[model samples]
Target: MAKRDYYEVLGLGKDASADDIKKSYRKLARQYHPDVNKEADAESKFKEVKEAYDVLSDDGKRSTYDRFGHVDPNQGMGGGGGAQDFGGFGDIFDMFFGGGGGRRDPNAPQRGNDLQYTMTVEFKEAVFGKETEITIPRTETCDTCHGNGAKPGTKPESCSVCKGSGQQEVVQNTPFGRMVNRRACTNCSGTGRVIKEKCGTCHGAGKVKRQRKINIRIPAGVDDGAQIRMSGEGEGGLRGGPAGDLYIVIRVKSHEFFEREGDDIYCEVPLTFVQATLGDEIEIPTLTEKVKLKVPAGTQTGTYFRLKGKGVPKLRGYGQGDQHVKVTIVTPTNLTDEQKELLRQFGGLSSDTSNEQEHHESIFERMKKAFRGE
Candidate 1:
């Protein structure tokens, strides 16, 4: 069957952004996955969406697609390039899913896989910065073989199948004409060389699994889910390639008294009914110390007070963020008879209608303006 336009397959416009293409592909992949959908054509549809995403997600390929509606210009003709000619889909799957086949380098040493370790920190530790030590299990170079797959006395030999070309070509007949397709040499797995005598320690793989302890310092004001990348701390490189990176994902534990907003801290302060009505000075807890905040007379519930420079220090700035304290008036649930008598007398003297009138006027005026489209 003929192929459909990539944009149409992805349900996207011609000018869809890169992020849009990725989002669309993720949605489609999830919906059409064989594990998720047991329909007959789910696998084929999944492959189509993956193919479309493979082209549209790339800037260079998307430009080519935009200029020439389809990537296969010579479709149905023998001269058209096949799926193997396009960029390798395995690499795309590796980038997104991080698995399938192991990526190996022929010239350089093979590097180890990157590692991720989640570290939970107290709110203060996240705000003030702290150094932490963690141990991670990773692959390292074999000590006995020294990263070479050949035995100590014997060395690797050139692959006889492809004669060190690292590739093999196969000729096939197409509609246009006979064409030759090149693929990685199976004999040497595209490495151009083969190990005659395998190493005992690494079993000819040139790597060993080991545990490594690393120290990582987290900066101040790092929010939850912040990643700290440590270069060359991951798995050992194969052959002699550079080591991969280790990412420390930060997770901040929720504080008992405070919540974070960007760099600032927020907390709710409970105020007694008498304090909210008569006004008073109260001591509030901050990250460092307690500070006194003045409560205005007739302070209502949900009133906010700002404590300057009492929040978390900015990670990349000089000044610290302010702490916002929301005042919540706590009414007495159980009152003594004498207290109830005093409250009743106070309520009788209060001008509740005056307060209601002001509130009603403000709300009605806004509603009238909104209704009139003003």
Candidate 2:
């Protein structure tokens, strides 16, 4: 009989990946399997599915089929047949029967988890490196069972259902041929063993939770959202696997007087109208300390002065940034009688006129004048 295309039999496209092919085949196998289904022609559909999976699952067979659509019986394994020439489709069989199907072992040891710690630092501390300690809840392997998940006195036993094979097999008859399918043992959960008695401490988890102390050293010039990684400092790994990593995220506190942008510092210094009109040498606050700043003559409001090497330190390279000082002129108010007279005399000397206050006399003022007959 003419054979159908493997991808068509599995209800898959030619672009299907290995995983996609296996998933479709498993679902169809369970549905049409003669052992599982009692419908008529169930055996034939099951056989066809197995045969298609056999060709598509095996790498060499799939390659031959892709090029020639079929493997020649004469050129097959031992020059006899294709099935004999190639190995069993362990991928699906192991998945169904709970055996070694691929390159990875699900129960094998894996690297520990990676943890993140957000560490807040002062503005100065971020500019200059600091060392500090922190306490966190972490997971560690249990000392009682040594990560075996078994009690100290008793131990785990081989699964009786699978007889230490970790899988179960079923023989089914199909139109294409007779085949065998394997699946994981339901009793042992595919581990080939059962924990008759679990550890009292971890309760079969093989791990413990405890508070841990970690000391971290922050580098200089770290900006907000900067990240630092410490190796082998994460959660405990299973089966003695390597530890994971710990990441420290730096959060910098904002300064009251100074505002930072990249490596530069910004500040606004208030100056009186007299100081702005007549320039003088004044002291201004910087990131480090107060420094003498010369106010140029005729300095206007919103004028900016740059102080070199007075800002923040560079994160990676050498040298510092400049500090920008913005000057704002403050106008005087509440003039006394003597001050007002002097100001009026000064205004007369100048050509500019003083602002006149608007008079919005109400009806009551007119009534008072009329009652006095004025």
Q: Residue-pair clashes per candidate, as listed?
A: 10, 8
RMSD of each: 11.3, 17.6
Q: What is the alpha-carbon RMSD of candidate 1 to the true structure?
A: 11.3
What is residue 315's positional error in candidate 2, in angstroms?
2.0
Using Cα atoms with residue i matched to residue i, what is each candidate's TM-score against the true structure? 0.67, 0.61
Candidate 2 on 1-374: residue-level lDDT in tens?
A: 88788899999988889999899999999999754575889989999999999878877557656866854443322332333321234433333345452433535776889888999999989987899999978888888997768999887777888876676666655443555556677888777768889999999777899899999998877789877888898988876777788888899999887888988989888877668767989999877688999998878666789999987788779988889998776656897999879866755654343433213333235335544556
| lDDT by candidate, in order shown | 0.77, 0.76
> Residue 203's C-alpha lDDT in candidate 2?
92
Tens-digit lDDT track for model 1 on 4-86? Answer: 99889999998788889899999999999865675889989999999999878766556555755553432332243443242
| Candidate 1 runs further than 4 Å off | 1-105, 108-113, 171-179, 352-374
